[model samples]
Target: MSAPTISYENHRFPPQVIAHAVWLYFRFPLSLRLVEEMLLERGIVVSYETIRRWGRKFGAAYAKQLRRKRPSREDIWHLDEVVVSIGGRNHWLWRAVDKDGDVLDEIVQVRRDTKAAKRLLIRLLKKQGLAPKRIVTDKLRSYGAAKRDVMPAVEHRSHKGLNNRAENSLCRCENENE
Candidate 1:
């Protein structure tokens, strides 16, 4: 059979160039400017603004694609919340991750009460399509109500030091925001 036809008529650069540009933005926490500077040193002449746009357009898609191809979850789910400041207002960010540290979902809310916890659970349920076999959370009363309401049958456990995984995840986000 003849070789497959190649199509580079409309694009300015090859697929490998675009993929590398997108990979630099997603695989690291670096800003677009940093990525641009790194590429500039390597003789690439792309702009930071272009990199920013590529990230916004392709980051979520790439993340979703990678997640879909990953192995099945095998660890207990961990849930936690942290205080965040957005638009000069204090907010709470609730997050859930699988046992191997894959972020399932996150929600930013005004409070960490029962309603917020329930919303977080709902969001995760909608994304993951099933409740975790076991849920581990801190000794927050709101979590108790949320667990009962959203995942009645899942084992809910609260113990000191058991929620370190979730707490560390939140801590990482906090540090990145600073």
Candidate 2:
């Protein structure tokens, strides 16, 4: 089911300010203080705490709206993760792609363990409000472990090449960053 609408009727600030603050917070990795400063520079006086609240309150609504705009996704899902080196630290970027090559969801974490896999799966389930009929991943034991717990009824395939769609999409993102 689609998410119910959230009302912003009682807030003191104009809806525009609230929307802009939420946009700035999610559009970039800026901290709340930085977002507050940027809004102040634009002559909008809002506190960092207020921005944080707005993010906590409205982020889901925005995400829901965006998802509703997308075409309904296919039931077959491809999942993959790759190591990304930032400075001297290693992080695993996990992603899920549907049969049509659309990104269903993504997450970045330091560990590529069962917990991380479970988290990605849970988040994807929550965001899409639908579970895939099948999931394909590389031969990662973590994915198998997570799949059993999170989506026991769904089919899980562990193959080296089945998840190339997600990996290739991540490559395109990395290429743009470079």
Clashes of 1: 0
Name every residue pair that clashes in candidate 2: none
lDDT of 2 at 141: 98
Tens digit per residue, CA lDDT, model 1, 52-115: 7667766666665565533333447888888889999999988897786767788889998999
Q: Estimate TM-scores for all models.
A: 0.63, 0.59
Q: Write the per-residue lDDT of candidate 2 for residues 1-178, one digit (tens) a residue.
A: 7568778888999888898899889989999999999999999898999999999999988866765344243588889999989789999989988877778888899998999999999998888787877899999999999999998988898999888877888888889899
Every candidate's lDDT: 0.79, 0.87
Per-candidate RMSD, Å: 8.1, 7.9
* Candidate 2: stretches off by over 4 Å: 1-74
What is the Cα-based lDDT of residue 167 in candidate 1?
84
